[model samples]
Target: MKNLLILSLLYITLQANAQGLNERVIKLTDQLDSIGVATFEANYSHGLRTEYIVTVSCELYDDSPAPIKYQDQQGNILSVTPEQDKRIRDLWRRSHESYDLIRSTSRLLAEEGTECYIWESHRNGIDSLLYSVALRDFTNQQDKTYMPDLSTNPEWSKYGGAKEGFILKANPSRFLPNNDMEAYKKNRFQPKSEISFTYRLTVEEEDEDTVYYVDYKEFAGMIDKVLQTDGVKSHPILITHDKGAKVEDFKSEIISCDITHPDLDGETHGTVYEIETAELANTLRRLLSAEIGNYVDRHRNLNYLYRPLQDYSGDMRGMFSSNNWVIRTEFHTKHWYTFDKNLSCRVLLHHVGSKAYVLVLESVNDFWLPKDWHKLKSWKNGVKEYLYLQL
Candidate 1:
């Protein structure tokens, strides 16, 4: 009877393992539709191997009555802006100067490390703008640096691997286009604009069991200063918890923290943490909401407008298979503009995991606004309000 009981337990364990694996596969299939399995596979094979993948999609609008133009570093017009000629010209000139500086001074640190260059220029006579260029070499094996290469590799070409390259430039623009001209005039047009480039690289490393997935999105907005005489001094973002907040309180373990451009005041900061369990996850949501609420209340004297989300069945239907969970919060206010009775701010939290892994999605909607500014005009027209009661 004891032997039979032992056999029964073994059978149950096997069945449970099989069930878990099946669930994971189904989740993967569902996520593939949203994130593209091919892209995920390429990143998994070449970049840092992450148990969880987070993809953020954002839409930016140019609401000015003028046209907006975007250009490459080489003065090539990538996007045309007819009405905003002055703004576009200023942007192009700034980009060109920075590119020229990077091309002149940038050099390879090691055979396989990274090289960076910065250029400083002035916009509108008073505002100072800085442009930066960075190139990473993934070919050197002797280097112990942690930066991952996304470019395709010549050696790995036979096995279907590739190396990636990217170039980006940023300058401050008027954050509020029309109504806040006074604030924009005072700041001298210094706000933040971030652009990033990403590609893939292939290298042959032993031990296929160890997957290397380099997350470039996390590296966005990073800024560093080199003394030239000495090595580079990077001022990355610092992550400090509220005195008693323990690692476990975060729901996931904190793996890494980086600050981009600390020299600039009031820049957005980013943190990457991993979640471990569902109970811890519930705690994480509460803590995040409290933190954001405290921040808004302290910084602004605005009343809170909360929009309770509808049932999430459609949005997060197959999250279990991908080992993913998402939480969304929207805060609204009536004071931002003359129109738009309800101006809402939203945040999305994504929790992704594998065995012994947790990834948190914070500040997903931190800097987003409506795509069509004309919508605000409609809000001023004032529509009637209706109320419904549910039994």
Candidate 2:
């Protein structure tokens, strides 16, 4: 009787949550229509039973674009800019259009069991925005009575499946020497490329010669350009890893020298500097274009295994932490019989530990458009190397 009561209560709770979600959606759709949202999509999963994962595409209504707004995972009004709106739209469009191709090639239903709602605006003078949302509902399998006591945490569990496990697990042996197999494998799956363009700057400091591995080559150059440019001081904002510090105002001062890892909870607890000026943001984007192109070419067909766009989303969502600096860009390419519409490039500089400073330039393809749960895979893949970087 107790067990029955418990199960009944659980069902009631789920039903209530589902109803609440629907109500929220109704409210959100009403709110979105006023702000020029052309199309809105919300995805709900069993695990995340409350709020829906939202993606929207917008068109300029009048001479000026309406303010695009939506909710985060926690259902708070997510902070986003016009650029982010466009990026999200483009990503969703590509993912929606090529979803079948991804499934046929990768052999996984990216959205296995989820309820989806899609709304398109029919406001006058606006070209009817078009989009498709695929829905599937798979009944949960019965729990197995017999289970294997795999005592230790299975390393393979971290990957999506056999293919991702194999591709991501394969060591980057080409870069490291064969004789040092242990060391090579230990640092193989770093967030950035195994190859680096090292520069030893002549410093006047008497401290222990700290070694910092920067993820991307472009980071140093971008920072240098930002510092050199005039009028930047007028719009300066301070970025810091200190959570207690207030960033309510912008001044011509930057705090914090280098970014370090997060605490036990994986929270950076830091304040970021938004690129308030178009000039600086555009400069970074322009510089990143060439480098991202090079990365796409080098990785080529292997992009299917190292989906970078998804990785960039992970970075943007803070699945990985590096305090003050994080930049994400997307690219598309068709070359050598390989066509990828969403390639991701994420950049950051991290203070790994007391010993070294590492910069990360992340470039990968969005081969598998896995669900939100897979965001941490990038962080997990490089945890060992990240720890080594700290050492």
Candidate 3:
């Protein structure tokens, strides 16, 4: 009974924490919407003749700090006293803040001619909570000086990533055509634009980042309340062994999953289920999608540039041993030309003699694979299948 009571209390605390996170997200969204409106007005006041679009992408990373430990110059580790530990925890909790504004851009896509303009700006050196309040004050109090009108800056949006304000006017625009500007203008403030928000909680013991919440349509509505322009999706994508494939065509493909296990007879293949109806298939798809999205976003945001994979050769037999369940998935794109566009991803579910299982996922698709793949599991020497989910 005592254990049950403790478990119930723990569950309640977790629920409360989740609720608090949602509240924070809502408050931040509201603050961002206000800033976005002010920014749009600020840009328009400076003669933006074409349709204006604002793309505001914000991310909050909440890291739960580990217990503090002291290390001396002699390389000896020491533990803090109870009182010291409490004080340290309090300080860490107070100092650590979440909510980072990734990038906020207000753009003007040319309506007819080959001209485009953009005002990209971001609040620096402030956490989301403080920035939200401070920016509100700045926008309301400063009025004309809320944000610089960089539309005249000669830099011309050359600085990659939206960290500062700059007006980029291009002749014969090389990017996406402004043909849809009218449609976007019509749909502006409609909240029908595509937007995605993902929340990931990394539990210390799991050592894996798990996406706790993901919403698209609803959050877009919240943002559209202020921007009043067709929304833009902020997720990042890499060419990754391009294979001369288009993103639109690649996303429609499905994954073929096969799990193989050893039986007394010899070897038994796990039953494959229909992806649309099977719970396991759905879970795998969701996990893969979230992982890929997060991975691409992290690399893109950090400006880590790398060449696409040209070729790779490695053996993958040892990781798919008889003792563990080997999960093999093949991603197939629509048949084009004589070559087959197929990629394989293999996962190992190691059984620790009971219900405890360790999962290791790998792929030759270098874009999908992490540099620290070995850190995910102990048995790290074997070649693993590559799994990349475009969706």
Q: lDDT of each prediction vs. the true structure?
A: 0.28, 0.28, 0.26
| Candidate 3 or 1, higher TM-score | 1
TM-score of each: 0.21, 0.23, 0.20
lDDT (10s digit) by residue, model 3, range 219-326: 223222322212211111111223332223334231122222111111111111112222332233323323322332232211111111111122222211222332
Tens digit per residue, CA lDDT, model 2, 1-391:
2333334323322533443323323343345444433222212111112122323322121121334446654658767787878775554444333322222222222223132112234332222221111222222232323222234523223221111111111112244454344553343221111111000111111233222212334443444443344333212111122233222222322232221222211111111123334444334333333343333323322211111111122222232233323333333343232233323334443221221111223333321111111112222211211212332
Task: Evaluate residue 359 in candidate 1 and report its C-alpha lDDT on the 0 to 100 scale.
Answer: 24
**For candidate 3, what is the TM-score?**
0.20
The TM-score-based order of candidates, best leading, equals 2, 1, 3
RMSD for each of the candidates: 25.5, 25.3, 25.8
Q: What is the lDDT of residue 388 in candidate 1?
A: 23
The candidate scoring highest on TM-score is 2
Residue 10 lDDT (model 1): 38
Model 1 lowest lDDT segment of ten: 219-228
lDDT of 1: 0.28
